[model samples]
Target: MKGHTIGELRIGQSASFTKTISEHDVYTFAGVTGDLNPAHIDEVYAKGTQFRGRIAHGMLSAGLISAVIGMQLPGPGTIYVGQELSFRAPVRIGDTITATVTVEQLDPGRNRAVLRTVCTDQDGTCVVDGTTRIMPPKE
Candidate 1:
């Protein structure tokens, strides 16, 4: 994968990645991050919550946005500078998510790009929305 240098990027450039959330994905993420929130791990407890069932960790879905920045739009060697995310919906096991990033602004002088990030489910529901700042590879 070849990454774009800051000078090579343009406003409105975009890329996406898709993956289906599996039960194992949720379990592994919870274990790795130590975020054993019942809403993510314990079905019985989750049944009592507003979600009424286990849901994938918000960050796990947000990571798909990071995947786009690091592996697709700017490709490899991208440096994440900042991100602001709003979780809009629950991601259940077996939900396929498509994460997309669009270049909203660019600062070649600073080698930075501002990207609009969004993740949608199979039904086209927006599950995660955010903006991120990244420094593309300096090539």
Candidate 2:
């Protein structure tokens, strides 16, 4: 998580971070986002939804992007400019999701970077795909 610097960034360079989604985590996220969709909070109700069981909120999985940019690649004090995302698959509780980001562009003068982001499950199933714009501190 250390030894990485802004200068190390390059187009196509990538990094990843993993998180295990738990039922508690799902409940907590639901509390925070007020997204108590039965598909995400109630097993029986979820069983009737298209997902067939409780699922984690898309944003909860997307939050992994923050772990990637703030703790791994551009690490600490990175400013988020914007992001674009598309949800591909439902993430269930207990799923270990890995979020990855690759530098798609870098602006040296501004210390900003454009990254392609992807979140996948242990089986390599994509849960979310997105792009982010960030500003990391200059060395």
Model number with the top lDDT = 1
Error of 1 at 25 (Å): 0.1
| Candidate 1 error regions (>4 Å) | none
Candidate 2 lDDT tens digits, 33-126 = 8999888888889898888888899999999988888887787767789999999999998999999999999888877889999999999999
Per-residue error (Å), model 2, residue 120: 0.6
Q: Which candidate is the best by TM-score?
A: 1
Could you tell me the lDDT of residue 52 within candidate 1? 88
Candidate 1 C-alpha error for residue 97, in Å: 0.6
Residue-pair clash count for candidate 1: 0
Q: What digit string (tens of lDDT, one per residue) describes model 1 on residues 1-139?
A: 7899988888999999999999999999988999998899899999999988999999999999989888888989999999999999999999999999999999988889999999999999999999999999997
- Candidate 1 root-mean-square deviation in Å: 0.8
